[model samples]
Target: MQFDLAVIGGGVNGAGIARDAAGRGARVLLLEAGDLAQGTSSASTKLVHGGLRYLEHYEFALVRESLTEREALWAIAPHIIHPLRFVLPHVKGLRPRWLLRLGLFLYDHIGGRKHLPATRSINLHRHPAGAPLKGEFGPAFEYSDGWVDDARLVVLNALDAVAHGAEVHPRTPLTAARRVDGGWELETPHGRFTAAALVNAAGPAVLKVDGLLGEAPEYGMRLVRGSHIVVRKLFDHPYAYFFQLADGRIFFAIPYERDFTLIGTTDRDHTVGEPIVASEEEIAYLCEGASNYFKTPITPADVVWTYSGVRPLVDDGSGKPESATRGYRLDLSDKDAGAPLLSVYGGKITTYRHLAEEAVDLMAARLPALTGKAWTRSRPLPGGDFPLDGLEPLKATLTARYPFLDAGTVDRIARAYGTRAERWLNGAEGWQALGKSFGAGLTAAEVDFLRQEEWAASAEDILWRRTKLGLRLSAAEQKALADYLGG
Candidate 1:
């Protein structure tokens, strides 16, 4: 195959760049080594926020950019991105309440926060969120962020890229690439392809990809491992908690899957390897961190699931892993000569759209074929063509239209696929028409949709990345679904 641009990696950054470039009239080919979002993209804290903590690091530009994109992302993909309130209890011995207030003040005003509510003080004893907290926690501050289906966000980007004429190839890793006279020849398992320009957005393995050309950059990347643990629901309320530790680190206890609480994120350097799993120490640290705030203590046994991802962060010479910057840098090799190669560095999920736009803008200067202007700022991803406030109404419409489906199933499908749910249902008049249910409202029809459309190749892709049905399905049922998909 031949294309105008071949984008490496299928994480958010790579997928986003492919989508933007393809939409701008560039014939794009996106290749991924595994299922989409099988890396750091899927293992994020799943919060779309301005990074209130980043203010402490004096990353005003990053904070502003992220705060700006937070709303823009929600506006475009409202089904997967929804407003969430974060409760920060003013624990003594940590950063003082005054610093917290000032940081929040900057957070509220920095990026032009309009629709989301501003920060306000609340008495922990009186607030519903405090019901799960310890007695000593008195006053707390509540601020707005957002919850996201991180993995789904990636798949949706790839879907939109395909919709816009890009060829997306998951499970196909780029084996090698050599710069030719006018373009480059790239190798994958399937076949060889040529492209006028190349993009290396390989999340954690970006540096490795850059090394393939026998050229090395001066700067290095720090592989920081962040891990999360999920347990039975810790609270009944909708608000998520931002608990501060005595060591000056912070973690979150957010409601997950309606029946569990999600807590995580330790910042330790990690050696990249296959099957990144959370260490026992990391799990214990997270449990202890949450136990310090919640009235009820937590243990490792309570954890139903754990996930870890290695972040390829720019090595800014920060002494601590958590202190590293999340901002990205776009490096263009052969900018003034030869075929252009753009390699993307560290970036956060919140700023992926801006990153992609900037990447394409940089590449457009070199690629004469890329004539289209910036347009993704307003274009909605696949299934995200509806209004931001229309999620519930759309859900109601789906329930009404598919009267045979239970309300819960309708809501789940509506949230996952948005208006595109209709496309998947495709005039299925009844449950039987939808095919057999493999538990958790997952049916043969939906599995077919995933395989045919979303590049889902395995049960792990469906249960863990495409949806969190893994948390709800039994081991036997999950195996059955896997068997069904294999057949």
Candidate 2:
């Protein structure tokens, strides 16, 4: 189909841009090579923070923008985003307490943190979160950030884009594209499409997508692999930990999926062709990093699941992977020559929305057809129409309405779909109405909703991205899901 805008990736940036542009009255088309968020978007550290550590590298602009987005995102997607308290324990040889205090003071004041609490000093000996930490670490700093279901965030954006009259195509790769005088002729396996503007948001393959048009940008990209591991619950509290390593890098240990703790994120240079696997060394590194602070030591053997994602950071001559900037830049391809091609480079998950706003603003300036003002700031994604603090009350209402479903199931569904969960339920009278049980509370009704509404195609997309049911499903259950979806 012909359109005013064609987004090349289904990750957060592409999805966010499509949603924003379409909402502003542009005819937009979003194309994904695989399922939405099947790459870096889903495999994030799953946070909506302002990059507190970025202060060390003097990225005040990025940190300030990200800080603002923390609350904006939580405000828009409360079901999938919520405030989180982080404990940054004060170690002896590491960053000094005064420096930590000063950094946190800036972190609090940098962005307007209204709903979330401000930073405070915590006595580890008395705090409940300290029970799991070693005695050597004490008097930690507590700060406010936000947590997110990264994959769901992207899906919700895509859903909202579609709702705003944008055409979203998953698993449709752009095989070739030829730049017209004032538009683009894109060839895909499905069909040929034309657009007045093209957005190169292919996360790790941003450069590759640009090359499809027979040119590359003036900038460079550094592919850094970050890995995370999931282990049995290490602590029994709602608080998450930010641990500093001796090598000057930092990682986090956060609660995950109610039954486990998610520990992660090592930054190292990785080649393009390499598989996205949590290497033995990386797994061991994360385990060691966590064990240094937690009273109960951890090992690679204790890891139940591990995931890895490569960050396509802009190469700014930083010597170490951790020093690369998380900020994004919009490169408009020689607009004076022809229709504009906006290539997004080097962005973090926390700043996707802001990047999208900037990208679209640039697009509007370059392309006359995309005449629209900045929106999406106050617009909520699909299912995110409720108040910021309405999740618990919404859950209560859902439970009261559907008493037949267990509390856990209701809560899971509510968190996943927010106010829109009712759309999936459709006032079902009882469990039987949900249809064929695939185990782990996954039913045929839910599967049908995923397939029909959320662009879910395979068991992996349903289990891993759309929901984290893969952790709860057994081998047989997963196979059953795959077989059912296959048939």
Candidate 3:
């Protein structure tokens, strides 16, 4: 097949670029080695924030860009994204109270704040968020950020790309690519294709893809593995936390899946081929860190689930992994180098849309078919056309329409599928109409919809990536699901 652009990667960045380019009139093809977002995109801290800790690294431009995109992303994908308040308690010795105030001051003002509330000082002694914390923690700072269903965000972008006439192959890996007389020739497991331009967004495998094209690595990459642990609910309040350690590191404790507390993110240098599972030491470190703040002590045995993702960060010679910059760079091949080649390196989820926009903007000059104007910023992704504050009302509508579904199921459906929930619910009057129950409100009808609409072929794709039901599904139930998928 021939195309104007061929994007190799199905993470958020590649998917976002496909959506933008296809919408702007390019014949686009997106190829992924596995399921969409099976890599770093799915395994994120799941926050859409301005990176408060990055300010300490003096990444003002990156932080400012992220802060600016914060609300814009929330506005476009309100169903899967929503406002979250973070409580940063003051530690007596670490980062003085005044510095925290100044950092937050810049955080609120520099980002063009609008609908979200401003940061405020809080008395942990009187606040509900303080109830589970240690008594020594007195004053705290509450700031605004956002939460996201990271995997779902990637899927939604891919769906929109398809809606705009982009061809997306989830399991097809790009095996080879070479520059030719006016464009580029690409080889994949499925078939051979040609394009006028190519984008390498292979995340941690970026340098490997460059090797496939016989190109030298233009920038250094620091692979930092961030590990997180999920445990039973530690606090009853809705507020999440941002905590600091004497070691000059920071982590977050966020409310997750309604029944669990998500604590995480350790920064350790990681080699490319090493396993991505959270190590016992990393889990114990996070558990012990949470213990120091919460009244209840957390231990490794308390962890119900653990995950880790390697960040492909630009190497700036920072001694510490956490100090590395989150900024991204786009490099286009010189005109004498034949067809255009754009390679993306080092970016975070919060700034993906802007990164995609810049990438398309760079490719537009080389490919004339990319003549249309930029339009992703104002356009909502699939199933995200409602008002920014309309999530509650959307949930109410789902409850009223599908009264047979329990409250938990209704909430899950509303959040996961948004306006598209009705597409599968299809006015089913009872649970039996939805077909066999697989535990945790999953049904044959929902699974069929996922397999048909989304690219879900296995139980892991449906349970872990499409939904977090893997945490609730039992071993027997999971086996049954796997058997049902014929895996």
lDDT of 3: 0.93
Candidate whose TM-score is highest: 3
Per-residue error for 130 in candidate 2, Å, reads 0.6
lDDT of each: 0.91, 0.92, 0.93
Judge candidate 3 at residue 342 and give its lDDT.
90
| lDDT (tens digit, per residue) of candidate 3 on 1-487 | 6899999999999999999999999999999999999999999999999999999989899989999999999989998999999999999989999999999999999999798999999999999999999999999999999999999999999999999999999999998888887888998888899999999999999989989998778899999999999999999899999999889899999999999999989999999789999998999899989999999999998999999999999999999999988999998888888898899999999999999999999999999999899999989988888999888999999888888888888888888888988889999999999998999999999999999999999999999899999999999999888988887
For all candidates, the clash counts are 0, 0, 0
Per-residue alpha-carbon lDDT of candidate 2 for residues 1-487, written as tens digits (9 for 90 to 100): 6799999999999999999999888999999999999999999999999999999999999999999999999989999998899999998888999999999999999898898999999999999999998898778999999899999999999999999899999999999998886799999999999998899999899989989977677579999999999999998899999889999999999999988999989898989899998999999999999989988999988999999999999999999999999888888878576877899998999999999999998888876666667778788878889998799999999988889888789878988999889888999889899998988789999999999999999999999999999989999999988998984
Clashes of 2: 0
Off by over 4 Å in 1: none
Kindly report which residue stretches of model 3 are placed more than 4 angstroms away from their true locations once superposed. Answer: none
How big is the positional error of residue 455 in model 2, measured in Å on the Cα after superposition?
0.3
Candidates ranked by lDDT: 3, 2, 1
